[model samples]
Target chain A: MSAAAARADAGTAVARVRGLRKSYGDREVVAGVDLELFAGECFGLLGPNGAGKTTTLKLCLGLVEPDGGSIDLFGYDLPRQAREARQRVGVVPQVDSLDPDFTVSENLLVFGRYFGLSDAQVKARIPDLLEFANLSGRGDAKIQALSGGMKRRLTLARALVNDPDLVILDEPTTGLDPQARHVIWDRLKQLTAQGKTLLLTTHFMEEAERLCTRLSVLDQGRVIATGEPRALIAEHIEPQVVEVYGDGVDEWASAHAAPLSERCERTGETVFCYAHDAGPLVASLAAWPGLRHLHRPANLEDLFLKLTGREMRD
Target chain B: MAADAQSRRTVARASPWRLPAFSLRALHVWRRNFLVWRKLAIPSMLGNFADPAFYMLALGYGLGGLLPAVDGLPYIAFLAAGTICYSTMNTATFEALYSAFSRMHVQRTWDAILNAPLSLDDIVTGEALWAATKSLFSGVAILVVVWLLGLADSWRVLWLVPLALLVGLCFASLGLIVTALAPSYDFFMYYFTLVVTPMMLVCGVFFPVAQLPDWLQSVSSVLPLTHAVAIARPLLAGEVPGQVLLHVAVLAGYGLVAFHIALVLARRRLLR
Candidate 1:
């Protein structure tokens, strides 16, 4: 189904960012970015650190103003209409911001009240949100006493306290262990299943692959590629990849595989060969003795490295 | 189609009340803060009381026993009023400055609050009100303690509570502005040591501003705390000074403009 149709038949954009830009002094942090998210679309932003994904999210959420261009939430201009727009939007910040003073349930109740939810309305939503976030048993626990993963779950639960239509999450699982990551992914999927819109930023290729339906690959404050996650990889890079690592892989790639394969790129000590099929590439690489070889399906990282170039940016 | 249009209009009309919605959230956070740190209230109150109490005992009793009274009042009454004035300033200033910074930056509390329907103005105004509440409570506590000790002799001293609240508005607004500008906690200490601490000492809270050097008296006249102490001191001594109205007006002027400045800075920090 088209993205718009999947969005609860609302036929409206939940968030629209046009030519958004943020700069600190002379350095442009988010440069001329444009994006649109419809309800029920799980839109992922994939980038390395300092790629302006977080800055873009902050601007869209009105946490920070854009240096240039405009952001609209459900058609309301962001800065001038921030309070109005925020009423229908929720944000799960990269850093956990749960109130250490309140219990998990109190935190939800207080935050829900911020959106003008009455006591009865807030109380009614608590049990479901607690279960969704896996915090049903710890609803009375102090935020300070909760583990990092629990805190992250509570933060996510807090965002939904007001039943926001559009949810913005900035690197929601950056430091989480594998189990924690999956739990969050499940909750996020459930949110989308309820026809809620989501905009997320992540550096983890695997997380984006598992969670995001549509994604934009951003590098140096600009979009490098954007489409459905699978389509972007298939359209831009090879379907299968053969990684050959040795002291002279780059030289070997240039002499042996550059002309034969669709593409050959060097990342660190490994040379990744992109081809429609890895059979010929694997067979060819076996002739070169003492060269390490590993074959896997080409994914977002290959597409990302292909577009952004294989330089050690950090 | 007509039904959909009506629904849209209803949403548009309800937009302006969003800030009050956020302010209510601030009150919830404040209540939660109180619950978590129930032990903190007594210590914080003591901190507010101890400074003035020590100064009053050492200066009013020990020093006054040596020197003659000012305006024919016992040194204890004179110093009790001044101590309460300075305590109000400290209570309001500390809550708005250090505690606000921690909530805004370290805890990321404001970010979460703003994500709801609350505007930047609501967050700041709520903070100012909470600080003012703390100051007023502290001042009243100090008044009761001194009254029990037979230090505050005047029934008119009850007026100091309201006057202290006015002083709180001034310091709370100023503290919010400082919190918006402060980059880190250490920066706040610099403001406390160099700016706020001096304002407390020289703002007619301890000695009469009239006895200060000509230039120092001129400088104290511009401080809101000086005006606060001016009004509060006369009431505590059972003398209703005619110029107290002028002090009230001066404090009101500072309160309005300081709150405006704080709102602008909070917008820059939270939204820009």
Candidate 2:
């Protein structure tokens, strides 16, 4: 579904932004953007580095004041009523903001107090929170003692202490290994199952495809496109892609360049051939015996690359 | 959407002074700091006590024989009151500058707190108050030592507790203002040397400010430590402090103004 269609289907919106704009000096970071996050669905904001994804997330949380825009979260106006809105919201920032001085459990306990939870209330929730994060027995361990994955899980678990109606995660699984990433993904899924709205930003296309029900692709401080992962691929890109590259691959590509697909991308030693049908491309690739190729269905990564371009942002 | 558009139109005209919106929620930030401080309470207390102890040994007794009585009191007795004031300023200033910076920037603790219902004002106020509370430990430690050693001339010395807290708030607020402007740990050297060291010498910590030149005395009179020492010294000597209300008002003025400025600067630095 597109962002608008998804909004129409959603029962109630957790947040809405209209014509959001933010700038740092001469450069416009987030320029004329609109977004809506609904309850019980995972919304993704995908962009390359410096695409203003982080700025957009901060704007929603009232951390960064927008140059020209307004945000309403749970019916409370941003900044003016930011404190009231934030009472029901949880945020796991892009960086590790966990307190190093406190133990793992102490981190949760202290953070709970920020939302005005009493000591007894915080303690009552500690066991369940620690268990959810898979750090049940490690509560007393200092933050430094926990591994990177453990710290990330603790950060996620910390965000849940308030039982927030909405959770905003910025690059939730950026540095984790596959196993740790899968665990976080499962926990996030559980949150959605419990009816919590999730808004996340990620450069990892696979992460977005796996978790996000609907997402907006941002580039150069604008939303270029917004839709479901598979729907976006089917609508914006070819149905198939054959990654062809190896020794003499460039020479062969140049020779049969006329019959090859019109939409092709060359990055270093590899050439990506995009087409509605892969049969002709596969048969033609058989001529280059020594070359290597893999044909697969087009995915969100292809649509993202096509929409945002393949250039490195930073 | 229409309501949102209406709010957006008014946002451009919002007052900049809204940056420091203080609330009672600051107590939570203070409690957070207290919970963390309790983990290393022993080392924390020892560190707070070390400076006052050293000053008493090195300056109070070491120079007692060479320096004559200050304002008709023994050198050690006079030095004790100044030590409490100076220690309060030092403890509060150091805590606000170094530890508060670590929480705000390095550790990103302020960011974490801001994620919740708290605002920048709550965090800054909590930090300033926590620093003052921490400084109280050092002030009280020295007060106890002086009392035991017979350095306190009268029961009026008890007033030093509240005086220490006032002095602590004054310096802590000043230090937080510096923390708001500091870009890195190395930036603190300028604050300690140019601001803190000068206040220490001119505020009559070791020697009477009355001995300084007429113009220097006027300069010292404006310093927060001077007011702290003025009230503290008279109380320690068993004499009623003259112009007590003015001295407190000056200290309070520094604290209130510095606190307001710290909140404003911190909001600008952290929020955008």
Candidate 3:
């Protein structure tokens, strides 16, 4: 929130979606969703599987018609004037779409044509864009030869071929290694630094906390919570977390339940104690010498788990 | 705004058949296919040309030597005319069904293109036209071979260029309709068997429609390929094709109507 806080003059919303609804057969995927993205800020949609994140993203791109809603993107109606609104928007879909038939540079060049850019215009930008993706000299490399990370980076570069104002990514780093994930995060940060608006969806809470200025946690196609990341964490969870686990941690938790911490949760062999401060929680750990404990500040993952149930969907 | 949105959705759900916008942007989609095909053009074009050449030469020389002249023309010459129509139809239909489906479903090329500023209308039209373009190439190659084989040296053959395009359009459009409805590559077998193969046999590609059973002759009259062969057979014989407008109208009608249906079904398939 602090890194990309809204300035005093920030007024115009880049995209405004209200009461969007969509259903497939008898199953309602997106029940009622609303989203508003302001200029030069990264907003995230955090949801578990089947939480309607991809469907919502598709609706914003005008790739799918909403069953019922109003979408005004760049001040134009959607799925109708979607062509015009999409003129200045770049999208990276949930699945990678870098054409395997073409080389890296060819993919970028051909995609630019779809946006009405001439070959010369796209060619001129290919070097810079490839460099941005850290694929400086692999322009002629086949898409089939590139690794997963390279394809992801190329997809990002291809999206920028039009130099779009708003970039929409659906789980940009879902299946990447840690290093690859960091590279994408760095590239996205550069985009934000250049004052580009980003609206993305991710189940990775840390990614949301690091990249999103504001986020909405979606459950069952509904927004359960929407606010600044740290602010939401502060509102929903205690400021500190103490994890205690050892041979007799369960017995120690019951003995010191009321007097020690505000709330506690036991999952598997770990007992998570939540409190406003770590001072008393840490000091209380001395009584149970057989127990091992660790104290740290609360994070967005804690808030997310608190809001969305901890049960595994499958 | 809500009312307007509702009305628009209602309109979309009610009727999807609007006149082709013929948006110039569809050429970008055509260009995409062109760029990809350019890589394999040499081998691909050869395959398209060779398939028909083998069939025509084998059937004409081998089978014609066994039978009397078909309609006062050498069997090879008669088969050559029908071969042009059948070859063009097969090329366009194959490109539309298999190649187009790969880009749409497997390669996800159309999904990538959809993220661009272009609409679904542009993608369908572009793919259908690209398939037609492939057939045109196939038609041209066969035409040149027919000329070399001493079938007809008349200027009348020049008119077949546009006819090839029309036949290509009709079959390509019909093929795209099947593509939109297909769930996988295996689904194309039914189209080839039920639609393409039947049309080839009864549409006078190998023999005259008059030889068909009375019921089939009536059915072949309505088939687009019959008109293509009808015009082509007369053109290869150096004669003015009878009912030129009616034949052209039939082929064009099939192309235009099938194109609209493909557009409609694809909107349901992809846009969902």
Candidate 4:
């Protein structure tokens, strides 16, 4: 809340969105979301798929018009002042958009020019950008020849070509392998250390927990919860989780555990209990034949499952 | 009173316009895809140049052998001017339509551009300039091949280059307007087959519009391509008319108005 309040200061609020409402015909995508992102801080948007995280980012960037809302980016009202707002920001979309025709350095050079950088300045930044994206030796490679990880890194490098004050990355490492993800994470850490503000959206709870200082959990186009990760785990959910495994565990939880636990929920083949201490919960799980399996501390994944149910929808 | 002044000062400080640093972002993007233009150059010329050669070889040589000349000029030369006009149209239209559409929709280069200090207007202007440049190149290619074949009838026909560019401007602007409205590539195919292709064929490309009914001839006279051919065909045949200036004015007007329309549509599609 202090961070949110600090963002109310004119100098701190890099992006502010209030009462955002959007719908595709009768189906509302973003019902009512209020958000403020401060300068020099990282904000992560945590949600399940189809939770309007990308839509919210698109609305802020003026790519999609909201049904109703006001977005102030660097003090400029969107989309009337979209050009002004856009000048200070950079974006890495979920899809790779590096020009297939251009080589790596050429791609960065061209993108920098859109920000109105001079030819000399564009050339000057190429070395640093190539090194930062781990693409220095591959500057001559065509975009079509690059691997998925390479493309993702190049996309990220392209976003920073203009030296933007604010960077928005949507699902930055969704499909990459562990090595690629770690490399990206290291670069992102360096960026944050430089005091450049970031806003990220990801369904990967581990990514959210790893990078974000403050986060919001969104479900069904609504902000279900928002706070620091540790605070959220402490306040709205249990610090420790005990998962009992077996078929008919739901029936067992209903009979033996539901009455004893603070919050006991069931998915297929497993029953989860959220409580202050898993020590007592583990002992309690030994009594029920169906609850033979035991688990340790809970995390954001458990929190996500607790808030958004296990029912599958197409 | 000092506190009130301080609050007023804070309110005044919340202005939206930031200092614009117009870097060379557009030029960098241009250089990145300049090679694509080089690849496109041969294909574009081949695509446009073949139209006149095919019609002249297939229709003019084959059909003209069976029939008399309509207005005393060789049928090859008549079809030659029409082919050049259609070449300009095809080059300008394709560059403005499919290529621009992909950059805006698929590549998301429009997103890349708008993120910089460049506005929607600048994007459209840059695209139009680029398309015109491509069209001019294609026009020159066709003019050269035609002259080498000794089909170019008049020294006055050299003016057809600028006139062809005018035709390109008209089609490119219209094509850009279509690109702004076109949702998918499939949507674009409909306009090309139905509107643009038919307009080229019926607007006196190979045969005289006078052979058609009087009203259809009148209808063809007002279209931008029609004036281009009217001015170009006569010039290519060693004839010049004061009325050609009227054609120039109409083409210029179309370019300006269509350009503005394209800018508005781009702004709506982008900023919204």
Please report the candidate that would top DockQ against the real structure.
2
Q: How many backbone clashes does candidate 1 have?
A: 0
Residues A157-227 of candidate 3: C-alpha lDDT, one tens digit per residue: 99999998889999999899999999999999998887788999999988999999999999888889999
lDDT of 2 by residue, A1-314 (tens): 23454345567888988878888999999988889887789999999999999999888888887778788899998867889999998898889999999999899999999988988999999999999999999999999999888999999999999989899999999999999999999999988877788999998999999999999999999899988899999999989888988898888777763376757888788888888877887888788898999899898889999998887889
Determine which window of 10 residues in candidate 4 chain B has minimal summed lDDT.
B7-16
Model 1 docking grade: acceptable
Report RMSD for candidate 1. Answer: 5.3
Interface RMSD of each: 8.8, 2.5, 3.5, 7.9
RMSD of each: 5.3, 3.1, 3.1, 5.7
> What is the per-residue lDDT of model 1 for residues A101-208, given as tens digits with 9 covering 90 to 100?
678998998788788888799999999989988888888888889888888888898898878778889999888988998899989988887778889999788888
Provide chain B's TM-score, model 1: 0.86
Candidate 1: tens digits of C-alpha lDDT, residues B108-215: 888778777776666777788778888898899888878888766787888888887888888898898899899998888887898788887788766777888999
Model 3 chain A: worst 10 consecutive residues (lDDT sum): A1-10
Error of 1 at B92 (Å): 1.0
- Stretches of candidate 2 off by over 4 Å are A1-10, B1-10, B13-16
Please give me the DockQ of candidate 4 compared with the native complex.
Answer: 0.30
TM-score of chain B of each: 0.86, 0.94, 0.94, 0.85
**Which candidate number maximizes TM-score?**
2
- Which parts of model 4 have CA positions greater than 4 angstroms off? A1-11, A66-69, A287-294, A308-314, B1-35, B50-72, B149-158, B181-183, B253-272
CAPRI rating of model 3: acceptable
